[model samples]
Target: MKKNKTMVEIWQDVVEIKDLIRSIILSFIFTFGVYLFVSPNNKAKELFFGLVGAVMGFVITNVFIKPKRIIIFDKNKIKE
Candidate 1:
């Protein structure tokens, strides 16, 4: 028999996947940004710096922006 999962659980899975994709994009952007900064003629150096920047961006975002916000809801106002 298979267990059923709630909508919230499905949403959470989607959110996790989105986060993973975002991290990859962020890393790629960072790498490109670093390459622009270096302005190196050699492709190898540019790639190296870009990779470093990508890793840096990914780490920074994960460390500082991954936390969730807390909000409280009031039921009294809605129960007219």
Candidate 2:
């Protein structure tokens, strides 16, 4: 037997995955910068800052910025 998902569930999962990946990538980038800036004095503080920065960056990108394009295809244009 196979399980079925509703449209809402499918979309929710997609959004969740997108946000998780985005946060991780952003966090890494932020961590790198923090490591450079504060590694000499406070390593732990740098890590804390990096995590905060990542969350802020992800929220800003996801909520304030709009994506440039959406991938929609025209069926009639397909070559059969």
How well does each candidate superpose onto the true structure, as a TM-score? 0.48, 0.36
Q: Tell me, what's the RMSD of every candidate?
A: 10.5, 10.6
After the best TM-score superposition of candidate 2, give how far the Cα of residue 67 lies from its true spot, in angstroms: 11
- Alpha-carbon local distance difference test for all models: 0.65, 0.57
Candidate 1 pairs with clashing backbones: none
lDDT, model 1, position 39 = 47
lDDT of 2 by residue, 1-80 (tens): 13442222343343344545665676677666656664456667777776666666666666743443367886786678
TM-score of 1: 0.48
Estimate, for each residue in 3-78, the C-alpha lDDT of model 1 and write its tens digit.
Answer: 4422223434433445556666777777778879864889888778877887788787687445333467866666
Model 2 RMSD in angstroms: 10.6
Choose the strongest candidate by TM-score.
1
Q: Report how far residue 6 has shifted in candidate 1, in Å.
A: 10
Residue 32 alpha-carbon offset, candidate 1, angstroms: 1.2
